[model samples]
Target: MSKQRTTQPITTGTSVIGLVYDGGVMIAADTLLSYGSMAKSFNTPRLYNIEDRILLGASGEYSDLQEIVAKVKALALQETTNSMESIYVDRKLPAKSLWNYLRAVMYQKRSKMNPYWNDVVVAGWDDQADKPFLGTVDKLGTTLQENLVATGFGGYLAMPLLREKWRSDLSEGEARALLEDAMKVLFYRDCRASARIQLAKCTSDGCIVSEPYELDHSNGWNAPSMIRAAGDLDGDGGW
Candidate 1:
């Protein structure tokens, strides 16, 4: 039997964006999962709360995303069970440890010529380091740690807005507002994106994933620039 591997990803999710705020870290993603060019699933959230204060948001192969998180959870459970009779303190995996584990996993798979085909955003508060943690790991196992991180379309469409507005002292409310704006731009530009948002936050208080909600579009799209842009697209027909 010949060994087979995933050569292409199907039923994929779109961008994920994360930023560290004053008290902790926050991440956001659209709820739409696309199958090729079709808008397939609207309620499947890409954000997963793996453990206390360890939040993961991923874009690309939805099945692979679920599989990776499940494997992590299983590994943690097994390790915890084995250590139950031991005298080691802090059995729960720290954010940095988890991030490193993921890097290893992704890299190993890539070396085998099989990859998860996902771009991930991991957010948490590193209590020992007394700082917020925000990072990204790609299908190729390349890793990045940044105060503000965006994946997929969000990296192109939303990063500028985040870079322009993010501050070290930003309040939680301010951070959320910035995400809301960035997501709206993504919805407008990224064809695979959804108006619905899945938000997660990890602070010293622990991680919380919010219910999926739609961007408030009541009157926000009535701007003169949007109207003129729409008119231009309708009027131009050189072909």
Candidate 2:
């Protein structure tokens, strides 16, 4: 008898988020790679800096994610080489162009009935146009541009927090705080999430991706003082 094939992702990274701020865009993702219900890696980054003004964040199958990253790097090289050789000075890859390219890739895979099984967020700033953009594309090829977006459990756990905290006039500092808060919420709720995260930004000046850093989790559930000062537990059975 013939067996059926599974199209769902087997090993995956959980939760990635992206947001657009006043003059830039920022994205964050955890470093946990899970194999089914098992923890695989604790230091695998899911965020990538594509160029000086473009960042890509993905949450899904790690192998598929790597393939996308490789494809993007190859495309960048091809575009750069073509720009250097062509007479036209502006025939280069822009953030939107890269985003469109990824969209096409996912769409093609979906059409073939074998999708990449990833939810990708693209954040970029166009210096010439002086505009910032944030968008996401899923394995099914669905694309959306929003003030804030998240994948996997992040969408359920952090999206509400982002929706409430996000503002059009938010400064970079304020945006960073909001992003961190959202990440903390995810870390607290997602079993596959960790306090260690990678953060990246795309601005008019350039892109900056930070090294993996652990978030401050002091005074959390692990703290020893679990009871309120007003409520005495020692003589709880007085009645």
CA RMSD of all predictions: 3.1, 3.6
- How many clashes show up in model 2? 0
* Deviation in Å, model 2, residue 208 alpha carbon: 0.8
Q: What is the per-residue lDDT of model 1 for residues 1-239, given as tens digits with 9 covering 90 to 100? A: 99989999989999999999999899999899999999998999888887676898899999999989998798778767777877774477667777888999999999999999998888888888988899989999999999999999888899999999999999999999999999999988899999999889998889999999999977767865555543366544322
| Cα lDDT, all candidates | 0.88, 0.85
- Which portions of model 2 show Cα errors greater than 4 Å? 1-6, 222-239
Best by lDDT: 1
In model 1, the runs with Cα more than 4 Å from the true position are 229-239
> Candidate 2 residues 97-206, lDDT tens each?
88788889999988978789899998888656788888999998888888899999988999999999889998999988888888888888899898999888888888
Q: Give the TM-score of candidate 2.
A: 0.89
Candidate 1, residue 114: CA error in Å? Answer: 0.8
- Model 2: ten consecutive residues of lowest lDDT: 223-232
